[model samples]
Target: MKIKAINGVKDILSDEIVYWQKIEKTARDIFRRFGINEIRLPILEKTELFARSIGEATDIVEKEMYTFVDKGITMRPEITASLLRAYVEHGLQVRQPIQRLFSIGPVFRHERPQKGRQRQFHQVDVEVIGAQEPQVDAELMAMGQMLLNELNLDVSLEINSLGCPECRPDFRKKLIAYLHERHDSLCDDCKRRIEKNPLRVLDCKQQGCRAMVQEAPSIVDNLCSACEEHFAAVRKQLDRLEVSYTLNRFMVRGLDYYNRTTFEFLTTDLGAQAAVAAGGRYDGLVEQLGGPKNTPGIGFAMGMERLCLLMQQQEGQQEEQGGADIFIAALGEQAIAFAAPFVHQLRKLGLQAAMDYSNRSLKAQMKQAGRLKAGFTLIIGEQELEQGRGILRNMDTQEQNEFSLQEGAAMLAEVIAPDKA
Candidate 1:
């Protein structure tokens, strides 16, 4: 019998790791620019935290989350709930009136994997907790725009308001009335969800269900005066900032927590997995989850896999598979003995240098160097070691030259690192 990786989880292998590193670095730099502090939360949390915050009726809680009934814990399906849990547990509001926090980590679910959707995926989550102003919502969306723009990705932003506890009920009533009129026409999943979670039906992908929802009333039309005012303020700020956005009535997030504002960064390239990032305001969530009442916050989480997918589709966008800077091919016993310290000195000078550890034949070592895509290969033979010199070969041009072994760094710098030279 053979062992294999779990069906839906995949490995980030060597050649592909550089791209992941680049994505993480870009997120960190952009996040830093916004003064968002990085937060590290545990992958496992009390199951009740999410069930209470994300709502038991949502797909994540009822169908997708990886719950552990016996241990009373569950792997987090998203970071927002966990972040909120941390905020309450640590009493973050007391430390600062507002906190801008971000996290980049893996999240787990039990769904079948597809091209851009994985059972175990990663997300870059950004949250601004404790602010009730619509300007913060506009800034959050703008920052998302900037991050994707920096990545050279083509994506569009769409936003909707989910009307808070004060207003969502009337919209919910209207939504349910419309959904009931066409309940039989909807898919079974949607038919079941309409009564318990009508907002979920609006996001259904089933063709028949989507057609049925097209005629249903939008929450925007049913928002109470307060919600309407808040929604208007948010759009006004976004307009002032020149951040273009579409008003997507059907873009209600799949969580029960969201209210007042819900937005997503979408791309058409990935079929059903269209949203690269999505989030919203959850004014009632902190109080709902046993924190200070009326606490307001907004956030967004970008799927790393989907972002990478869109990144791969962009024209002229190259995958950065960083190769070795220098390879020291040590031949003969004396040359092999001289390899370690020689490579160390090159590295101390900031060169990514490596040498043969097994002391393979010169031909074999040279082949390895070529395989590694090293820019330059240094050949140190017995005679060269005795003479305190080594031959440097340009792997690309196959041009050969010599330099003092004691001056290996300076010699390599002349051709490869001219600035250092």
Candidate 2:
């Protein structure tokens, strides 16, 4: 029997790695500018962490999590739960009143794959902890916007509030009662949620569930005084920063720990999986995960694969492959001996340089140079090696010139240097 990769997973080959590198570099540069340091959390966590934070009734916790018992400990499906665990156990004790943390790594979800959605996906996550102030929310959103803007991705921001615990209980009761009236019209999952987790009914993506909840009561309308005030402050801060957004009353995050502010950075270009990024305030998450009380926080996570897909679609092109600045083609045994040191000298001067190791003929070496997309080709034949000189051909313009070995290296270095070039 031939073994193959499991379904819903795919390999990232060399040709596609440049796009990933570009996106990660852009994210890292933007995050650094915003004063958010990178934090790496383990891929696995105690399964109970997600159960308490993401909630037992949600799709992620119920159907998608890759949970397993390992030597009496349960492993988790995703990294966000681990992120929260790290923040509470280790980050909280630090003196910093506010911590800005970012992470980029793989997360597992057992969903059927399509287009950009995968069973194993990567996420770029950012979290701001120990700050209940609405400005922190605005700042977090701003950092996301900055990253998108830097990438030149045309995306829209959708904002909502899930009301704090003080008001959500009443809202859940009203929502459940409304769903009970339309119980016969709901899908089986929504029907089950009506009793177990009434709030989840609003998050269903099924056509029938969507239609049934069109007139359902919004959590925004039932916000408690404090929750309403916090939401208002968040909006006011966003307005002051001139961040454009749509008020999406139905945008309840999948996590149960979220409170007050919730958001999703969406793009219609990605088909049904339109959300490129999504997250919210989880003020109660710390306490839920056996840590401090009332430690409010907000953050967001972007699917790197989804972002790359969107970028490819929006740009209508793939990133051009990077190549060496020069290719040294040797013609004979003597030329080969001379070319080795010359190529190393070019590289030491900070120029991308490469030479054929297979000892092919002159014509074949030239062809290989072209295939490598080398900007310039240095032809070191017997005559040139005898004279300590070589022929340089500009691959782009097909212009040929002759120079001594040392002179050619100096000229290439000059072209690469700012002042001399």
Candidate 3:
């Protein structure tokens, strides 16, 4: 019996890897220009790391985390907690007051998967640690915009402030009071969230819960003096950078650590899964997670699977060109022997060289070359071997040229890739 992949997970085969490669490449280039360095972390961490950082009330901690109860380890549902854990454990603050870092990897969650979401999904997380200035928040959003722009993705940006510890309690009380009045009308999830995390009810998607919260209090209106100033400064800097954005007062982060400025990049192409990227400030989290006191941070993560889906939707699946730069079709056993080493030499010179090992007929080999979409086909038959030359045909133009067989790979490399040769 053939085994099948488990539900909520799928393989990214060769044909689809090109989109991922382009996304990663574009991200790296943008990160480099922004002076952001890369970081890598383990997939598993002590369950307490998430419980403390993500908050036990979160859906990720309550229902979605893939935890081994006996082992006390859990697969990471997101990257921020693990990154903050690293920052504190390694005393990264001693080396630099502020560190700009990014990480690319898969994060595991136990959600019911749908289009653009999987049990194991990839994300590109960017963080600015130890920077509390409002400009840092603005610049981070700008960096996200630049990355999406370079990818040619048309996504809208929405910003909001979740306030801070100083003033959020007032908003929470007011919100909870509002929720309690309509308690029976809310969804079971929102009803539970009312006490544990009243803010999450504002983010609920259910029609009933969403309608209940339409008249709810806005956190942006409840910011403390300091938080209000910081938020205003963030908006001012974003304006200075000419980064366009709309205010979303009801926006609330799924994680408990977020505070102050929060934002998401939205797209209409992905149906209900509208957010392609999202993030916010977490001023107190570094200290909460055993890092030095007052080490402020803000970061964002782009859902790679969602980004790829948007890319495929905008440009067809086969938009990226794949296959060999050149295909060597050797007709006879003697020709195959000669072409084998010749192809290897071309590869060493930085060329995507492919040759069929099967000693098939010339017509069959040419057909294989066509299937590979080879730019050039080098035909070496008994006749060409006798002539001490090979006929290189430009697959596109169908123009053939004779090259001295004795010169071998060097002569061919120069012809195919003049810049490299």
Instruction: Identify the leading candidate in terms of lDDT.
Output: 3
* Candidate-wise lDDT, in order: 0.88, 0.83, 0.93
Q: What tens-digit string does per-residue lDDT give for candidate 1 at 103-149?
A: 99999998988898889999999999999999999999999999998
RMSD of each: 1.8, 2.1, 1.1
User: How far out, in Å, is residue 267 in model 1?
Assistant: 0.8
Best by TM-score: 3
TM-score of model 1 (CA atoms) = 0.95
State how far residue 94 of model 1 sits from its true place (Å): 1.8
Give a tens-digit lDDT track for model 3, residues 167-282.
Answer: 99998999999999999999999889989988999999898888878889999999999999999999999999999999999999999999999999999999989999999999
Question: What stretches of model 2 exceed 4 Å from their correct place?
Answer: 1-3, 72-76, 316-318, 407-411, 415-421
Instruction: Kindly report which residue stretches of model 1 are placed more than 4 angstroms away from their true locations once superposed.
Output: 408-415, 418-421
Model 3 per-residue lDDT at 78:
98
| Candidate 2 displacement at residue 348 in angstroms | 3.4
Clashing pairs in 2: none
TM-score of each: 0.95, 0.94, 0.98
Candidate no. 2 TM-score: 0.94
